[model samples]
Target: MRVVVIIPSRYGSSRFDGKPLAPICGRPMVQWVYQRASQSSRVETVHVATDDERIRAAVKAFGGNVMMTASTCRSGTDRVAEAAERLGLGMRDVVVNIQGDQPLVDPRCFNAVVKPFTEDPSVKMSTLAFAIVDEREITDPKDVKVTFDENGDALYFSRATIPMGRDGFSGYTIYKHLGVYAYTREFLECFRSLSPGRLEEIEKLEQLRAMEHGHRIRVVVTPYDSPEVDLPVDIRRIEEKMAAMGIG
Candidate 1:
């Protein structure tokens, strides 16, 4: 089971421009992501997929593998699929799509995501989910929620809180959907062939496309909590965490 981790990074960002190149501590954000992915024992190779020449050069400067993708890619999944085709990923190989902004992503999360493929040969797509610790996250539209079946396969993913509790609903479990995904080459080809579903358009979640096409997506639960950098103020929180951890 050879696994390749692809970090999709683009220079243009609406919230924080040049986010991939932003310096975290002494290194670029993407560099941190790449380094973390490389630590995964299950991952055979790590590649940074980007559209900007500056990002490509930066990855190269750090002696990291990088691939140039087209600017027209609508999402990170699309970018990774293009890279998989460009790199000639065989049908049997597994490709893990890792988020570029999550500089502090847990290596264990990557390992857990790819583990399902090893257990079940039929599993084509997989992702990670974390139990929400705060009640505020349950109602926050930005924090996507996911519900799974008895087999731990995802039934639905939505921006709104699912399994609506009764009037006095208390202690109801909630899970926050992580953006990381693992896809087999055959699933990637099938994913590209489907049209975006109405639910996906309504929620702006690309994973819904797979469910719409009747494909089962295995859900893996991870105990690690990742702090994402989405706004300018987020840099301060990450810096403070790094300082406390002595990561430089």
Candidate 2:
């Protein structure tokens, strides 16, 4: 039942290079994420998993724990699985995967994502979801939408509008998939081993791989919204949001 937070970082980004090291409110984005994640009362430890030495150095410079994974890792999940193996986490230990790009992730989101594991031993993986309040996000490809079953298990995660109204129906709520995720160390290892699924490759949503493999991911609805830094301009937006929230 140890909860370990791992942030998969990379120095290169097609949209914004050195994204993990990018400064936000006078601190590197990764540092902000690490510090916030550490604030979670449920988290036992936090580690920055990166293939780049500069990101490793940056995390180390900030007195944060970091581990180097194989550069060949194609996604955050792969890097986290490797980091989990290196850290020697037990099979049942809960591994929280917090994306480095989300500097303003609420510490409470960590607890929300990890709660399912404690309540249900069969829950091997879980993720946060928020009911979309902003109207524009419903059709925005950048905002991934998720549909869940009555039991809160994810039915689908997509970039396109889900529960599409063929006849202009608009009564349903669309949930935005928050980047935060949690997995048992064993399932994480299994996730990394499985080949990418067709829907995962098509939608470019890695979470779909689990569903395609018949794995039911519990969707934890959370009130907190964690925005990501996709381009250089997003830093200022995050800073503004942080400042408005009185958060550094």
Candidate 3:
């Protein structure tokens, strides 16, 4: 089955307005995401799925594919699902959801998340997680944390520091959940039909809806940590990282 990468973007955001088109190193943020996602060895195609015409135009101007989705779409996953349908993807095809905010995402992360389905035909959903090297991320709500079972299936993803020590916090390896996700087109349709869970609403995390419905999410640990842009202030930091990594 083919692997498709869809970057869902919106013009309006509570924190940062017009985030997808925001300039980072003189290029729209979505361009960086699209270009990096295209670099994936396993990805067959990449598309920007959004309801806003501005995003569509920007993507097209950069010679990238764009699909217009409904503005009423509930989440990025919903947008990706609609785009997948438009692309005529089959149930067994792999669909990778990469957020536009992650301009510096590593191409290898895309391959890593899609690897599970390649190894096991039964695998439906998978995501990337990076172990916390920065202590601040453990308590930062913006950086979602996750804990997985011995088999690498996610146990729970939360904004709070999980497995809190009764004595003191030390030597705990917290894993930060990356926004990148891969799903079988069949499971994506199932995900769209599933009702939102209480925990999902509380955490504001859509992945919880799958867990609440007894779906197993395989977590792939990647050495690369992709920093997401949540505000205008984060732009400088991204540019700095870009320079340090020798990325134009």
**Highest-scoring model, TM-score:** 3
Question: Per-residue CA lDDT of candidate 1, range 1-248, in tens?
Answer: 67999999998888999998899987998898899889988999999999999999999999999989999998888899999988898987899998888888888888999999999999999999999897888898888999999999999999899867876437777899988899998898889888999999999999999998899999999998676889767877888987987775
Model 3: per-residue Cα lDDT over 1-248, one tens digit each:
99999999999998999999999999999999999999999999999999999999999999999989998998899999999999999999999998999999999999999999989877899999998899888789888999999989999999998767776567667799999999999999999999999999999999999999999999999999999999999999999999999997
Tally clashing residue pairs in candidate 1: 0
In angstroms, the error of model 1 at 206 is: 0.5
List ranges where model 2 is wrong by over 4 Å.
Answer: 167-169
Residue 156, model 3, lDDT: 98
Tell me the deviation in Å of residue 191 in model 2.
Answer: 0.9
Candidate 2 per-residue lDDT, tens place, 72-92, comes to: 998989999999999999999
Which ten-residue region of model 3 has the weakest summed lDDT?
163-172
Ten contiguous residues with the weakest lDDT in model 1: 163-172
Give the Cα error of residue 246 in candidate 1, in Å: 3.7
lDDT of 2: 0.93
On a 0 to 1 TM-score scale, where does candidate 1 land against the true structure?
0.96
Ranking by TM-score: 3, 2, 1
TM-scores vs. true structure, each candidate: 0.96, 0.97, 0.98
Backbone clash pairs for candidate 2 read: none
